[model samples]
Target: MEFWLRVTRSQITKEIRAGRTDTWAAFALVVRLFREAMRKRAAGDERLWGDLLRYAQDVVDRTPGA
Candidate 1:
């Protein structure tokens, strides 16, 4: 019983770590996408649109600091 409890806790920790990694990866992706879109627009692409704003808003909405 104790062993299983320890295992469960370990698994939960691993899952949480994985989730954090995923979150960072997603954030980086959004930022890059936003940057690329902006660059294209600056260069007169006209069709480049929509990116990190929504994701950023979500971050602000959820963050305790916000």
Candidate 2:
């Protein structure tokens, strides 16, 4: 199998199945994604970043754990 470091649903799963993905790296990407979403939705001061993290965690949780 090929080694891909990119962060994507398919790539992550493939790497995980192939025993090539780093758990920290995948979680870091998730955190970065949550940050990006929060950065874009900068509206009236509200707790959206936490929500984004929760949502991202939910998505990760749905997949097989590391």
Model 2 bad stretches (over 4 Å): 1-21, 43-66
| Candidate 2 TM-score to native | 0.36
Residue 26 CA error for candidate 2 (Å)? 0.3
Best by TM-score: 1
Error of 1 at 28 (Å): 0.3
lDDT of 2 by residue, 1-66 (tens): 233344455666777899876955976886787677667677644467677767868988988753
Per-residue CA lDDT of model 1 for 1-66, tens digit only, reads 899668756765676688755654665675698789888878887465544556667888899763
Scored against the true structure, residue 3 in model 1 reaches a CA lDDT of 92
lDDT values for all models: 0.68, 0.68
